[model samples]
Target: SSEVQMPMQSGRDYSLGEYFVEVKVGTPGQPFWLVADTGSEFTWFNCHHHKARNKTRTRHGHGHGHAHGHSHGHSNPCEGVFCPHKSLSFETVTCGSKKCRVDLSELFSLSFCPKPSDPCLYDISYADGSSAKGFFGTDTITVDPQNRKHGALTNLTIGCSKSMQNGVNFNQDTGGILGLGYGKDSFVDKAGRQYGAKFSYCLVDHLSHRDISSYLTLGPHHPAKLLGEIKRTELILFPPFYGVNVVGISIGGQMLKIPHHVWDFTAQGGTIIDSGTTLTGLRLQAYEPVLEALTKPLTKVVRVPGDDFGTLDFCFKSEGFDESVVPRFAFHFTGGARFEPPVKSYIIDVAPQVKCIGIMPIAGNSGASVIGNIMQQNHLWEFDFSQNHVAFAPSTCT
Candidate 1:
């Protein structure tokens, strides 16, 4: 694939869309705009559309992400594929005002619409198999005035989902997601075509605690050196969906054999390399060996949380470090190429005096394990479906 030119400025650093900071939402009395999510393109948020709502101050109550006077077991807003004007996550639908409207990508053009009677409902699906219903409309957006990275507005589109994911871990205050992906239909790419290209980002380590400046690098503004120089790693681009490949795994310089499985590629589909995702999920066949590698150190000291997938370390609450051992993961791509994560890449936090078990535990998993951006941060990854391969060139993300 031909290299893309991405422009950059001196002291002022930014790619295309927003990053780091988030905006808060709600009415004047209420604070916050919304946290923008490039991982998601369409924008939507909890609304005030409930008939039982304080119809006086709050306008539309019975909304998307927020449920007022609702029950979980009784009603599910996302019951059907298409929601015209009826859906509630945990609320008893006393009123009829839940519908999806408009395409988020067309939001900017959607404003000052030469037409009025057009429908604005849209259905959005996430990588986790969750869906939401919302409308696309132009609304005023404001970033923190003090923060330069948050203040500058380049190419962005916001959408509000009257409804959103029920049981998930994301900034719920979001009106909706700000998607910056490969599809030409996304708002960021659509609006900033001249400056945008396939999306790219680099995640800082959890330990670095460094400013996680993962910007969406787009357009012809990148450094010429990045384009002129060439470093290519052999990659066999699988189908776009949840395409997970456990080509090979290694621990402490020892190789472990495992089965390979792919993830969903298409929309609401399979797994691919997602820079935005935080954890790297692998299938059971791949999970077992990796988990065993993780458990080897602290079987007696660290309490193992047992489940179908067995003991996996996803803890906000931990007793203490069982052992202070540095681990590694090496992935063998197609051909003779191999990727060995540096100690800093897998370690929990790299700052002085902080040590962590770089591996997580899982009993078994069917969902695709993600090689998230954190894993790819040091490498300049190039995904070219057109060429049937994705290449990675090592870099510090300068």
Candidate 2:
């Protein structure tokens, strides 16, 4: 199968904190900046006719009250939304069809349908408390490859959301979510079934300017420059989540004392690589040590008051600090594979002279940790379902 590629944009310039990719959905292909999420299962779009509440609400997507920093002066932000009727190829899914009954049972429940011919409906509530309810449909979507030859995928299932309530991290300009999770209904799973069970993406730094583009590629096209340096690890199959064996962690080449059960999936803990989440979350056992090691060296910078920094635990004045003052951060996976991201990825620049530690603690005792998009930035990650392994290597993402 030929490679299909799309350029990805960072949301910082738009005052949004997530990363986005322009997708051409439906016939004659309408463009939308869909948030690229690997943690979600179903792909969905916003309906044009629905209206968002005309009030300013603070977002807590990153586990804190972090606003978008800019106001969109409009009465109804959903005015010029995606018009589903305009797409000639769009068709609603039947309530009792095989696609709705078995294939998409995770999203479209059979109990929701009263009659066989009724439209299949879906109501999903995310982990962040945001909700979206809508009917299911199928449409043709165009795929853009670098060679200028456009390919169309037909009868692809999607959710045409009638209402979407804002959550902790959703950008107002985001038309929908591009689901790249492990579920059967996801774009990655469906597209991979026909094209190839291999997909890859290179995420640019979260704070990169709009002009600098990252990329998401679908197929066996691994960049020639990074093949030799790429490291491979087994992907622990946990439905809808890509789990990895995170054995240990290191700070400036010194390994920290994180518990074994914290990394054990069969026990009380495990780690998943999630693109939907904005900040990395570690279990309390892992986070305490990481926080101590990272902060123990910074004696020169003054710590900001806890109340002033929102939910972010450690914020310091960036006046006298450079990248050299912080130790290098790396994640050591099973089989000796270590992923060392740039210092800027974790020590994020939130304001003019304020830098905060981007990692957050997992809320509960579930012992799950998330390696969010910020930590994965500037690295080309490839998921090969056929081989049941994921590969990664540092790259410029040019």
The best candidate by lDDT is 2
TM-score for each prediction?
0.54, 0.87
Question: What is the Cα-based lDDT of residue 224 in candidate 1?
Answer: 18
lDDT, each prediction: 0.41, 0.78
List model 1 lDDT by residue over 1-398, tens digit each.
22232221111122211123233222111223232343444544555432433435443544633453355656754331123233221221111222212333333222322334443555566654556654543332323332333322222333445666642324343333444444344444443443334434333333333243333343323231232243333333332221333357788778787644432332222235654444455655665677677557544453333232222252221345533454666776555456665655554332234433344323344454566544554555554333444555555554
Clashing pairs in 2: 61-168
> Where does the lowest 10-residue lDDT sum fall in candidate 2?
61-70
RMSD of each: 11.3, 8.6
Worst 10 residues of 1 by lDDT: 8-17
Candidate 1: regions farther than 4 A off: 1-118, 123-131, 138-158, 188-193, 207-214, 220-246, 261-271, 298-301, 304-324, 343-367, 373-398
